[model samples]
Target: MTGPRFTALAQSLPATVPFVGPEAQERAAHRPFAARLGANENGFGPSPKAIAAMAAAAGEAWKYGDPENHDLRAALAAEHGCRPENIIVGEGIDGLLGYLVRLTVEPGDRVVTSEGAYPTFNFHVAGYGGTLVKVPYRGDHEDPEALLAKAAEVAPKLLYIANPDNPMGSHHPGAAMAEMVARVPEGTLLILDEAYVELAPAGTAAPVDPDDPRVIRMRTFSKAHGLAGARVGYAIGAAPLIAAFDKVRNHFGMSRISQAGALAALGDKTWAAYMHRLVAASRDSLAEIARANGLTALPSATNFVAIDCGADGAFARRVLTELTAAGIFVRMPGVAPLDRCIRVSCGPEAELAAFAAALPGALARARQG
Candidate 1:
């Protein structure tokens, strides 16, 4: 029998994934991690109301989810002061990114993004045969000027920036982002990943008009609302651009339980505030732990902190290895300079305490090596 034919692009791609979950590590080691602090998940968890809603929705599992995502889109539009036509709710930001890439990128189309930023976006771009032009970050931040310059040079079909950036936990001010938006080249469509904005300080979200065709802002319940597993996310853009998603997206991909949970979560402002405070405290705790270890914890506006390992990428990797060995799950950046730090997700005091206890031993062993 003959094997099914694979496309040239599929054959050319490497057999690799962006991340390895902590569960995989636990299974490999035959032991569970003492603390789960990687993956940038909101360990503070979803709202109680959301939990109840999901429980209630469990009984309706037989029915397919609303393909249009009407109610959720309407709620999101009201929150953003835009019409429902301006929003597109999808499985999550990751899934929405894939759809966006499929719609805009033909084979060999150019795309621009920060080097060592979110790998998932790069994965989607590559899957669709887009050529990526990556620019290195300036210090710990994604340089808007650098990205803009490259776009002007390459005239890429897609451009991506993540505010309150991952792995480094650095952010550009909303005004700075607004300035960047104004300078986006004529044809390039900007993808602003705002997964962590709900946890960031006020004035951190760019004041972009929802009807602006040049950019699309992506938000997720995965971070602030602690609904990562639920896989609910939405995008805001001009009505026409938003409508384009209908062509390529998975219509019934969203789950009924997830939709109900997200709806309940959105209405729970009190729970959202509580998670914000909890995450802030957790960030402070992580900073203190890093300080005690003679490391520097970079200022963060998201639900994680990047603790510089006082050396190069190798040293940070050693530290991460030691932590994992000690059952404290954590992650680090994959590239140079930026990889000099380990990323830890914010969690309750108990989990953070486990991390604090393991850190000194991890540091000592890493230094010895």
Candidate 2:
């Protein structure tokens, strides 16, 4: 019997998984990590309120989640001072990214992003047969001007920028981001991914009219909110831009319990503030850990710090391998200069202690070989 044939685009694509998850790694290693700090997930865990809400709603999991996502959207709209029409909730920012790429990209269409920015976005763009035009980072930060220039040059269908960017954890001021937004070409759409916004310092997130049609800003409960496993995220944009998501998005994609949990999480601002403090403290502690090991941790506004291993990508990879072998789970950037650094996420004392204990040995082992 003959096997099924893939579409032309699928046949043309390489079989690549953008991220190798921790579960897969554990399966291969035959052991659990002593410290799991990679992937920028908030290790402090979710609020008591959110946990309680989810537990209460778990019994009703047999029913499909609300297709409209009405209750959660309304609560989110009220929190952000926008109409429900301005919001589109999804499984997570990753899923929302896929939907956005599908909505705007045609086969061979152009998309622009930072060279070493979020790989998930790039993966989705590639899946849709969009040509990715990448701009290298300037000074370890996503250069807004360069990105804008490339967008204009390519007249890309979509441009992706992650404020408080991942892997590096650097960010531009809100005013600077607004300036870039103003300069975006008329036909292009900007995807401002603010997954780490809750951890950013004040004024780091640019102020924009939530109704702005030129860009859609995505926020997730994954990072600062400690709800990564819930897979809840939302996009804010002009009503029309947000409404378009409904045309192709999986209406019943959101888990009902996740909605309840996220709503409770949003309402408990005090708990959010507490986690913010914990993250800030963990960041400092991780920085100190890096410094103690003679490594330099880059200044960060997110839950992760990019520590310079004072060498090239190969050396950094060696350090990462040793660390992982020592049961410390962390990640590094994928591109050249940035890849010289290893990224570590902020977590509770116990996890940080494990990383701290493992670092010197990891460095020593890497240096020996």
Q: Pick the candidate with the highest lDDT.
A: 1
User: What would you estimate as the lDDT of candidate 1?
Assistant: 0.94
lDDT of each: 0.94, 0.92
Per-candidate total of colliding backbone pairs: 0, 1
- Candidate 2 per-residue lDDT over residues 1-369, each given as its tens digit: 988998999998889989999888888899999999988888899999999999999999998999888988899899888899999999999999999999999898999999999999999999999999999999899999999999989999999899989889999998888888899999999899999988999988778888988989999999888999999999999999898998999988999999989989999999989998999999999999999999999999999999999999999999999998888899999999999999999998999999999999999988887
Give all TM-scores, in the order shown: 0.99, 0.99
- The worst-scoring run of ten residues by lDDT in candidate 1 lies at 172-181
Writing each residue's lDDT as its tens digit, candidate 1 over 22-95 gives 99999988999999999999888999999999999999999998999889988998999999999999989999
Listed per candidate, the RMSD to the true structure in angstroms reads: 0.7, 0.8
Model 1 per-residue lDDT at 56? 99
